[model samples]
Target: MIKYIDSYDFFACQLDNQRCRLLALPWEDVLVAHILPRLPLMQLFDLQRVSKRFRALIRLFFTKRTTFELVGHHVPKVAFFSLVKDNNVLRKLLLESCSSWLTDNDLLPVVSRNPRLQTLDLSGCNGLTRHALVAVSLTCVHLRHLAVARCDFVDGPSLRSLADHCGELRSLDLSGCCRLTDATICYLAKKCVRLTFLSLAVNENITDESVEDVAKNCRGLEHLDLTCCLRVRDVSIRTVAEYCPKLQSLKVKHCHHVTESSLEPLRKRKVLIDVHPPPRRDRLSLAVDCGPYVNIQPLSARLLPSGLNADPLRAHMNGPAKVSDPWKNHPSFPPVMPHLQSPSHLLTLHPSCLVLALRCSSSPSLWSL
Candidate 1:
């Protein structure tokens, strides 16, 4: 019984010694090296709530690697607010579709902290305005890839500020920014010489002049989207094909004036061009004038009765209603005799009558007769 008691006490002592050794070890180092890095972003945020020590470790992790992405529609606002509330080492921040909880105020505080941000994507964040973009441009001078697509409040001045500050910008997407004009694009083209990918889709005010400027200045451009830009014409396309040699993909969908002939040069260069079909003209407008014979039956309609008992030479001078399939029925004997009983009947008709029928069917207006 005494040996059993001694064994129990010995086991308890070993357990206590193990606990002491673990407590003596640097848990913060363990967390920073192993456990924290494995945890996902949400779990890391949750760890910050555990204690001041874990929060400090998270801050250390942020300092070590400045790239942070807070995307998703349901990401709690508090998560972001807490992240940027006190820290400022973030370099790449992407906040997409978080507009519900992410307001301009929340974003400004974060932006003010991360002055070295390189890649920022606030796409679909409608709450952002020109002021926010300007702040980003002025503060984040190293920005390279900026996407503020669908941010309606961004205008020429905001873009100019961004171009002026972030001259190294390589990719920019301002799609659906209705207020942008040629001036904004021209400024960007002049400043952002390294731009490779640009999307200015749905900016109706941008004309061929801006595209020409882009072709001239942004020689490094590879992909460009000018979809729904109605003012762009063949001249701009030809200019781009001639100048932007590195151009690879070009989107001119819904630009009615761009013709297939103008895009042939780009095709020769192996550029991927996306062009929508030209708007179709009205069929009635394309109809040829039939002159006085406009009342003549269409070529598709039966010009005479087709039966063994039917008169071969009798011409039917019926109106459009009497014409049987205007599309499929052809005038039996070329409009000459108006009616011919057979091939031998052509010799019997007067030469004038034959001439009149031929003229009627061959008339430009009666081309469809």
Candidate 2:
């Protein structure tokens, strides 16, 4: 009975050893196809030092991966090259954060390899020059969305090269590229007619001509940012309002000449603008001219059309329209002061009081009769 029990125990030990030796799936297939691919790019570097087999598997994994995004990673030049050297099938390469050290030599090789790239975001890559831009334009013709924002080294000729080659570009962000001028923008507008999202923000060189050209040519433009473009005026805004029917959002912040007159049409169309429309100068001028003696009404009633009488206060409100004596005509209207009948009484008030009264007119409660 003791010998039989020893044999059974020995058989059980052998079975357990066999089970441990044989995996459910092959190790190579499991690591290369499943595990390595799932691991983050940075972790793969640590995993590569595990063994020769792991290093080979990581290389194989990168060769099959379609997207490589390492935003804000302080990747060394050598490490960046090593990670991307094996990756040739990349469709989207986003390395915005590595802008500090990323150079033409490091980027050109990757751009050359990945001809099928659809989106490339290298925003803030000030280290790169027009050579990098030219290389990307000439090589990655399939690019649709490209963001080189704050890459001030990019010049007009490289952009022209990009526009010429990548005509199918849909979204392009050139914000903070101070070297770009109106001519570059015009050429881009003419070539990239399929653009739906564009930004020329922070470039003071951008003027009404370029903006108007973009509005007319890129009618499909949905999102446009012209922030800090001081030269962009009301004319270009009006042109945009007329031409860009599909425009969804517009950013004209810091545009001094772009007033409510041009933006009113866009407002009516429900297009979202980053800057709030300035108060109508006409209304404020009229208010100031009327002086402190006039009875102030709700701003809404003052802006109402001559035919529209929706405001209940319209009957009592002392507005701009020349009306007969309301006290005699409408019994409900309050009695008129002596100053209401004569305009000369307004000029008698001190200049400081007039200024204070104008400021107070903004609030109905603070207004003096």
Candidate 3:
């Protein structure tokens, strides 16, 4: 009996050595991650092939390694936190750990194991909609910088959850989250009052009402990017001017409604056009007026009904309109202002004339593209 036991012990010792060698491989990061989890399930199925002591050591290392991975970075470190599919085994593990990291309401799991995590970059994690943000805000309380530019799941429930829970949030980048609307803006304003830097680029749903709410709540806001927010008319900028007193840098490109007057609030507006915006006295709708140099006929022609614009055109059939009527058969009309016929013709002179207009209504000093 003693001889048999010794033989078994020697075989177990050799098995432990082989398993350790696999774990020690340093050539691939991917290999370590793959093998770590399997150690648990592998022991349950194939431990007999290796010594009992070797199996116990592998399980111990697996637990320790996972804990290390979770708490590894805390400084300016960046990480990707995403939800796995329902069928994924890891997803089941994550779900089981769902204990509220920040709130008392839900027993959701908070990912606060890392004290040094600063930048939580979830740029393209499609599965992690608003449902997951609440937990993050609670767990990552030290998180000052966050980028969720394309996640669309952040609707009302999760957004409001953040404001109520994560009041420390400062900078947020929601550049391409198109589904977010006025309600989300209001929640952020009312909850996360510390938001200093924000980017709403290409968010098609945000309008003047949303801007007003943000201005009211986030008074400390400094830098704002309103690029591609098409509905942001003069009203939106006007609100920002009245509310966001500390604003410094702004991007209003493609905001056609922006005008020199709209820019009266900002100290320095970043305009991406070569030509200097027209004077305030000649300001258009909010920022684009047809005065300082804009032609009169095209302005009235399109803004006015075709019936009215046709009146002067039809009237000329009797005899003539005037030398200034560029469309008439006047002698000097074509050479003087060659492209001065229809509103479309005037717009051909300057493409910025589409129903779209943008301006830096934040304030005004020097403007550039």
Candidate 4:
């Protein structure tokens, strides 16, 4: 059985293929799990070598959930076609029995039958090519939340399949999918309209144009991560604000072209956002001075640009605290408030008196806070 892979999800080669597997049970016994189509992959890996009869039985395990589970657990008739309720959460569908059981053609039947499976985690399934993705997309109608993080052998065709079928897909992680190109990303954007969380950290070939596609197709997307993508720029961030009105978080570390203006939308946006930028002038850093709106300081922002000084910043930061007692005394985490435009707009921190910040003052940017 496959094991030890998770992060909520990692952005790259998520499941390590050390060429060594550590399952607690005897190998031969697992393949014969009482169930067929829905047998826990952990059990099926045990019986493949027993005989030709077991091999034939294993082939049948790739059918409907009812048929698969018949050999193992009984499914309630009422739950036959239940759909996933959480559009944001990831799904887990076991296909292969184990790494050793993997072969070029072994996973075909399972792939052909698992249409609309939300999360098909064939993580250590190194033997599968991009073709399996095509098969799954064609069958899995509820297909959303896909994670092909480490199956390096599967390439663009896998993405092509997901794009073709899983239009309602919400979360997709392509962290170690290094071979992807803008054409593939554009294809995904056009089809996946409900995508909320997407991770494409190490896909070095991607650029700001990919962000354009995400914004246009997935308007409700809440979290977007481009951690190690080297080509992203301000146009990408701008596109995000314009297209994904529900966007709540963005991560763009190691992207050299990004700057403070990349986040100018935060000042105008009605929603709160979590952003990871280029250390300096990142929204995360700005969050410290704008906490009433649920802002957290940027993870980086070690040094302000040449002309900015901390004293003016300190004074600007202190201005809001002086007038907004609620924010000054509030707990570290607070409930989200809509219509929030700035640190001072939060209902929890409404000002008792008018105290306009000086336009030319030392902390003109933050002093008004």
> What CA root-mean-square deviation does each model show from the true structure?
12.5, 12.1, 17.5, 20.7
Model 4: runs farther than 4 Å from truth? 1-101, 267-369
Clashes of 1: 13
Give lDDT per model, in order: 0.71, 0.77, 0.54, 0.56
Candidate 2 TM-score, true structure as reference: 0.70
* Candidate achieving the largest lDDT: 2
TM-score of 1: 0.64
Worst 10 residues of 1 by lDDT: 1-10
Name the weakest run of 10 consecutive residues (lDDT summed) in model 3: 83-92
Q: Candidate 1 lDDT, tens digit per residue, 309-348?
A: 2222223222223433322344453433333232233323
Instruction: Compute the lDDT of residue 338 as modeled in candidate 4.
Output: 23
Backbone clashes in model 2, listed as residue pairs = none
Comparison by TM-score, 1 against 2, better one: 2
Tens-digit lDDT track of model 3 for 1-369: 112223334434434646654334542354335444543332323443466554554444433342222222231111112211111111112221121131222212324344334555555546454656777666666667777676676666776776776677788888888878888887788888898988888888888888888888899988788888888888778788778777876787887767667775464554233225564544322223332223233233465323334455444444444523424343322223333233333432321111112333444322111
User: TM-score, each model?
Assistant: 0.64, 0.70, 0.46, 0.49
Candidate 4 per-residue C-alpha lDDT over 269-347 given as tens digits, one digit per residue, 9 for 90 to 100: 6444344423554342223343322322222234343443345445434555332233223343233232324544543
Q: Candidate 3, TM-score vs. the true structure?
A: 0.46
- Between prediction 1 and prediction 4, the one with superior lDDT is 1
Backbone clashes under 3 angstroms, per model? 13, 0, 27, 27
